[model samples]
Target: MHRLIAALVFLFCATVRVFPHADKVEDRLVMHFATGGHPPSNGRWEDINHRHLAEVKGTPTLTNIGPAVALQFNGYTDHMLVPIKPEDLPVTAISLAAWVIVNETMADGGIISYAQDNGPQEKGFALGFDERSFTFSLATEKADDGDGKLTRIRANTPLTAGKWHYVVGTYDGETMKLFVNGREEATSKEQGGKILYPAKGRFTIGAYIDDNEFHAMDGALYEAKVYGRAMVATEIQAAARQNRALLDHESSINKELKFVVAPYLQFGTRDSMTIMCETSAEAQMLVEYAERQPLVSRTRSEEARLINTVTLSGLKPHTQYFYRVTCTDKNGNVARSDILTLQTAPGPETPWAFGIIGDTQRNPEVTKRATDGIFALRPNMTIHCGDVVDDGFAKHQWVSDLFAPSATLFSHVPLFPVIGNHEKNAHWYYDYFHLPKPEYYYTFTYGNAQFFMIDSNKDLSPGSEQYRWLEAELRKSKATWKFTCHHHPCFSSDENDYGDRWKGKAPEGFRSGDENAQRLVELYEKYRVDVAFAGHIHSYERAWPILQMQVNQKNGVRYIVSGGGGGGLEQAAPQRAWFTVHVQRGHHYCYAAVHDRTIQFKAYDLEGRLFDTFELTKGR
Candidate 1:
């Protein structure tokens, strides 16, 4: 009897070990494709689990990466397939993860999918690309009253093409989640119950199962993995961190020429300013400055870094200084920037002249001409109302279209720029320009005028941070004149006011029929703002002192749209708005001369023609 009990106990222990609880099971499949062994022409990809090997279709090449290998897909007809039985796929919980490097933008493509076909009844899951966003979907038989439906979650921010990114999709029975770069981007509820998978369906990588759909990936893929159970947030984050290390390793392989971007100015003030520049290699920076043409004072930064910035203080207000920057790269290459001049802000009660320009995208030559015209006016400083480049992400645009064309003007005069939609709130804009605190929206005092630069791309309704800050700044301001600059005119008469191609639908933050616009107008009236300047219509428009959308020249505010700074021109509406006093279609800019309580304004076209002129007088 004792021997029989021992035998039964041993058998029970063996059964428990073989059939653990479903939640306790840690079943996973990892595929490091083409990393070590090359697949045959039949396209069989071996998996680490040894249970299923993928079948390759079309033509895919194996590229050597050090001692390992990586698979390349032509994005058209190439794909890797793995036949999976219904029982092999996870039903209650699952996770799919991959590291991908997209070659270019595609209309539509699948990265990984288990669906049988593109039909509505196809039962499985798919992680794919739709336009610029990454999408994840799950098909279930019970989703839509037994008719079979798909539950999809998309990443909040679009993924940039031609870059390496880590993506993961998981379903924890009750919730569906999508993560990008270790951060949870999107989530969906009501995804409980088991997932549906067709009995004969095959798991596909880099292409959909439907041959006629042409939804194939065009990129390089590495380190693909799948798990039967949904991975917790910490596990997914750890996978992303590991992928980042691999990306860093790949980036460190190439050593190219340095000095991609030239030296530029930032944080200009009455007595201090900063000079910033970028280099491809580590470098030391030196700057020489003096009041005269031949610089005498020298400042040097000993620390070596790719991005270099140095501040110069103890400067005299209302004085002009000449400076030059020199950098010594790690490889002993020395480069010197052009000698430039900087003019400090004038003291209180001093007369000052400043220029305004806007919408200079896609017209570098025209922008150069306008800057020359503004320089001819000899303004002490400049205010740009936004849209500085056609594409803020394109480095060449900033160099050829903006910096190179306006180098002389930028070096001599401090520029206060408003955030434009075209800039896309890119980090490069923030890195290049140094504005007041909370740079997107801030106020600065120059002479007897207080200039406020705001980000019209953001929410500015009553309780918004920007709106509250603006009200406080206006209430506390003691300057004799107040001026605000931003993209999107507060009172435009151009076709842009009618929306894109006259759809009659305005942009969210734009001035026409927008809550932000109405709130801003009320603030302007209450504060007795001297003038508000804006761009984005690609034309010139000036409104009479307007209050509550009507002419109130006594104490109301003037709204001007001077978007004609080199962008393609747009015509004013056939029937102008009631407040529109003058409007013109041309590439132009505005020049303002402020003296105590009076401001003389002039608008000029590219040909140096003075199209509009006005004067503002406050406090008698």
Candidate 2:
């Protein structure tokens, strides 16, 4: 009984000590418009009861659309505007936040927009979402430019399945940021002009003009606020958590993208480049704010490897550009070292070549052999299509198999590494190398084809998230050859055991089966996934042009299991009919030659003698 009482007392004390930001003051204010019996017509009042307004829910019943109050609009000309007199007006930096549910995209001709009195474009910003996909669009216009600048942030998933979400925009002198559900989604500093004037115009909740098509907000809205001072990321994150509990209790929420993919395209005229890196963690948790921001103006996070990313601006594309990483130690010491160079992707006329390797396990010496061969060939870049290391993230395994032998070669050539089952155990792959998201799956476009890397070991089931992502990525591709690489071979020789190893024990959230492999095969048949590669069988087995296990001859995906890089030999068992091609048990590497018209593959033994060759002719 005494121990229980002491535990309760300890819990109370711990709760009291739990404030992470007690020192910093939060500049926040909230206002609610309570309408009596009748809904006010004038634009002065921001109505809190959306059901009466008819913005979202109907007259008979109010659909509790989470954060928003249903509003109604009668074809009136003037719009609704709420009085927002900040305690400290004209504060240099500030944040404007609100919750909105748009049942439809912004009306075209009526022009129900968000505007302020500062400048024409500075008037206000407008947000629209396409109903079918819930694609969001935010536009800012200036009178001088005549036409408004529109930026769209498409949600990977739809929002209007009756869900309430948070949207916040912040202006910090030079940079303008847009956040969705309290997570920063996009940013732009390329505006030619400044914010016309102080945020003096009346704060408008819905509709620019009175009773415009966009009036009274067709959807529901809940908590709204505007701060005179720029709220740090911690404040926003905490609010997001609270909002999730208060408003959206039963909706599927995704963690925000860690960082945006900074544009890689550059030209002779551009002097500097700005790369946007994202982080799911709050800025306060970052270890080195300077290294994370790098732009000199922002001092946000203090964590190393925070999602908030490093930006490299002022770059000359096509020219050799060198950069160094800036991180910090536990003591907050700035550690900026290891200068690296990136010779940006060549211009339209330049022809480039990259090599491909798969499954360099069993023998660490295989990395040396493959690197030596690839180096001799003088390929501009190299891609390891998964299974780089043998087992899970054992630190020593990486040293012995990956970095040691291939370090020299990789340092010279731009090497793209994918997540293999072996590389997933420790999550050390991202620490050693800086690839894109470091997720088990990702996509990148190369010279003529686009490459997709998937984590087959974890989840490859039909209708799974990875499968959906693959379909979306494949659909968005402009490349003629959509090449996919994973650690587990989708198709392999019956000789060496091939198929799903973790067939029954996939994680709870993941789908079961090599369904992804077969489904991918079907998708390849439909969308023309030119070549698929895998490494796990420890042998070199190539598939003939096949669709649903039948010979399509012309338009089918060819699977290559090149697991014999340095791994132990596993001979391919003989299989008849359209399913089998030449299966070799020799210790060899594979090379692909891609041209505008045709792509050719040659499997060569360690002695540099070609054993098997195949070609893919392009369509008219």
Candidate 3:
């Protein structure tokens, strides 16, 4: 009888050990810009095919010159602007992509402008770049009302050097988005007002109406594509990650980057399976690199060593799992690899919680300290509201400011990051994280809430397709709570930012600059959104339930600015009619708890002492 019991126990242990095989998720798509690409049939603006100086005609050829004619640039370096007639093409969603090697950096960096004209100066929209960093921006105005304003959504990354890099700008009336390579790095919005033009003239590129002489492009331009519809995030990433197909298993033997998926994997189990690793290099040399790792679980095979890869499965859906990479080449050699982590989707059945962090660009040490604090609190997941690394486009700074300091915690946490104005490389943010949407704006769910992670640093207007999508999402959500997080603060107390203040100084719905700010605030109020958070100002603040200045606690949504994840120090605003509570200035990390009845928030300094706290009740 005792022997029989032991056998049964062993069988039970083996059953529990069975692992699940992983189903592969399709890779995100990235659209590449070769030269002379064709626009959608609706494209009518300055077609790259009909250049005034030289015809760049072609039918979306991979190269610049072709027979079908793909895109057209104004080439009006001498002050001549390209004009587009509405009859030529009417578009609700548009994205512009190109590969450029700048001839020289601008002395002060002025506008390298792209404008939609309604006859010379009647009214229209304009996008430009700052003189200092080749950062992109947007400016719009109504020629008749003069009520339009400029919304500058600066790219977080830099446009420097003579290297080839992909750049894309997308405008869906409601949201302006910018992508580098294939990753979204910035987003912004214009309120309800139009940067309306008289529509009498043509669209222009490179030179503005204000220029004295028509200046032609000084740099090489390649692969410019304009799409009439908003490009899906997944489609964009897949294109970006596409590489020349290497020789298959049946082909050559000289390849070095080939990776093999392991066998005996269960669909949803924690069993770590071994992957047989071998290279063209001698087995002994490969073994030398393997034995150095401590976490690598391996065994000797006939041709190579079988090392286990950490399998993150059977987790509480939508949670961050911390892990490390370990491997063995041959000869019983082992080495410890870098620690890494991933966030699992919420179990197909329920919702979860996550935190937000942003702009740790100024003071990395403080950011590091805050990161430790956030990890200690243990959120199901986290979000960096852009600018986690200053000079984000710069490779070295990204390592020091973001990766190095945050690695310890990041390895254990799953972070869903949004594009900030600081990331510039087409692949700057992509090479770092495994995001659900390779592009900048994405949507995810947790518990009773649906979160909209958007880009507020580029030009997305309200009437655009992005806005239409947002409306559809809000309408479809059955979740009890709705939250949105982005970088720039819509209404903040940064006294230096005159744009945030509205006291008769500016009309309520008037050109307060970036009407999207005003429009978003209005939408949140209308939809009964529970909370909205933002970070650009580098301080911690909370607004009272307010709509058009009248305290509508019952219906008003709450707005919080918690950008103080250790960037440049900033002061907060004092008590105001619209402010329920606030922490104008502090060096702290934000904490949140999603519970049955309400969503609670608190701010903590590096020492773990609570500096600010508030409770937001939830319900119909």
Cα lDDT of model 3 by residue, 497-539, tens digit: 5333334354333221234555577667767777787777777
Model 2: lDDT to the true structure: 0.51
**Best prediction by lDDT:** 1
- Candidates 2 and 3 compared by TM-score, better number: 3
Which portions of model 3 show Cα errors greater than 4 Å? 1-322, 327-335, 338-353, 499-515, 573-577
lDDT of 1 by residue, 467-573 (tens): 99999999999888889988877777666554543554645232342345556888888998889998888988888898777788788898888888878888876
**Whole-model lDDT, model 3:** 0.49
Candidate 1 segments whose C-alpha is farther than 4 A from its true place: 1-262, 305-307, 499-515
TM-score of each: 0.56, 0.46, 0.47
**Candidate number achieving the greatest TM-score relative to the actual structure:** 1
If the candidates were sorted by their TM-score against the true structure, best first, what order would they fall in?
1, 3, 2
> What lDDT is reached at residue 181 by model 1?
77
Which segments of candidate 2 are over 4 A away from where they belong? 1-342, 347-349, 496-516, 574-577
Local distance difference test scores for all models: 0.72, 0.51, 0.49
